[model samples]
Target: MEFDYTMTTIKPFDVAVLAVEEEIVKAGMRVLYVHDVQKSLVEKGFQRDQFKIVEFCNAKYANEFLNADIKIGLCMPCKINVYVKDGEAFISGMRPIVLSQFFPHADLGEMPKEIDQIIRNIIDNAK
Candidate 1:
């Protein structure tokens, strides 16, 4: 099964980052964190392309999945990444449905499919 959802954007890296955060909120998910991977690396005396990791979650959905199988906590708080590579900007995330394959014993019901669509929508709109 496809495990990732990715989209290339013509928007600048900074613009794509804001668009992603805005889309996440518009989709009714709360942004938990934004990790500036490149900044972190640069601060440590390294240089790399721009990259940001945005983490978000819908409380109700998270509760539902966790209740279904506590082990699902390992995947809690979904993430979408914004990055510049080879002069191109990209917005991407792991497909939520992939969790089903990772935890076959858990009954995810319709949550993964639902989340997968929301994430894909976010990436498309952000781009």
Candidate 2:
């Protein structure tokens, strides 16, 4: 089966970012940070396209996992990358639920699926 990590939108990056931010909070999660990855790359003197990364987490779910296995901290603060190239915009991020398969304790729990649906909605509804 093919796993999805990235998505495209007809809207420009600015509008898409707004939709993504609104969708995340509407899902009852708070955004942690919005990283300017393209700027970071530009500062390093490498020519690159524009890219923004939005990170977010829900405290309740986060705590549930931490209470299960501390190692899962490695994937905390799940994020989405918003970028524009050739006049097209896109949002990209790892499927935590899919990757959670490696951590049976976390996968078996309902939290991953709960969060996955929210993330999926954010991606699916963003314009």
Candidate 3:
């Protein structure tokens, strides 16, 4: 699951985020919450309409991962964000596997690969 698509010019960040969402949905997971960052920011006095954070979780994945290591919970219930900048829509998110790099003892080597694939697929399908 290298998630390296050389044929397309889509930003890896956006693709990865969208891929995760699509994969989770295809896996029969439910969206627990969608925080509209643009609206929230506006309400908070930020003048912008190009930010959003999508929170999703698969119960089975979460449970299994948590049982494997509780510390991983800090990055659980993954989030993907959609935002606009310089006339382009950009997607951003935190890759759990990348985060795992900070903690070598955490066994997320296998899980991050799966997650990366999901994210790639999402980006591939984005219009």
Candidate 4:
């Protein structure tokens, strides 16, 4: 099975970042943090492609997963990344269904599929 979902666009990196943040909110999720990876690297005198990590979560989903298995917290607060590479901006996120493979004993039910669609929609909309 595919491990991730990604969309590429010619849009500027900054514009892509904003689009992702808005899309997360539009999906009824909260943005927990936006990590400016490029800036962090620049601070240490390294230059790199533009990159931002957008961390977000839907409280109900988070609670359900955690209550089912505390270990799910390791992947809590899904993340989408907007980054530039070879002159193209890309949006990518992990496929939630992969979690099932990682925790077969946990009763995640249909959540992974539900969340997978939501996350794919978020990335597609943003792109």
Error of 1 at 61 (Å): 0.6
lDDT of 2 by residue, 40-66 (tens): 999999877788999998998888877
Q: List clashing residue pairs in candidate 2.
A: none
Q: What lDDT score is found at residue 18 in candidate 4?
A: 90
Residue-level lDDT of model 1, residues 23-109, one tens digit each, is 999999999999999999999999999999999999999999998899889887899999988999999999998988888998889
Q: Supply the TM-score for candidate 4.
A: 0.97
lDDT of 3 by residue, 6-125 (tens): 223244534544554665587566667767777787888889846657787778778877877788788768766666666566665565557456557766657776775565555445
TM-score, structure 1 vs. true? 0.97
Tens-place lDDT per residue, model 4, 5-79, is 999977788888898999999999999999999999999999999999999999999999999899999998899
> Candidate 2: where is the Cα deviation over 4 Å?
1-3, 85-87, 105-108
Compared with the true structure, all predictions reach lDDT values of 0.94, 0.81, 0.62, 0.93
Q: Model 3 Cα displacement at 110 (Å)?
A: 1.3
Name model 4 segments beyond 4 Å from true: none
Each model's TM-score, in the order given?
Answer: 0.97, 0.88, 0.73, 0.97
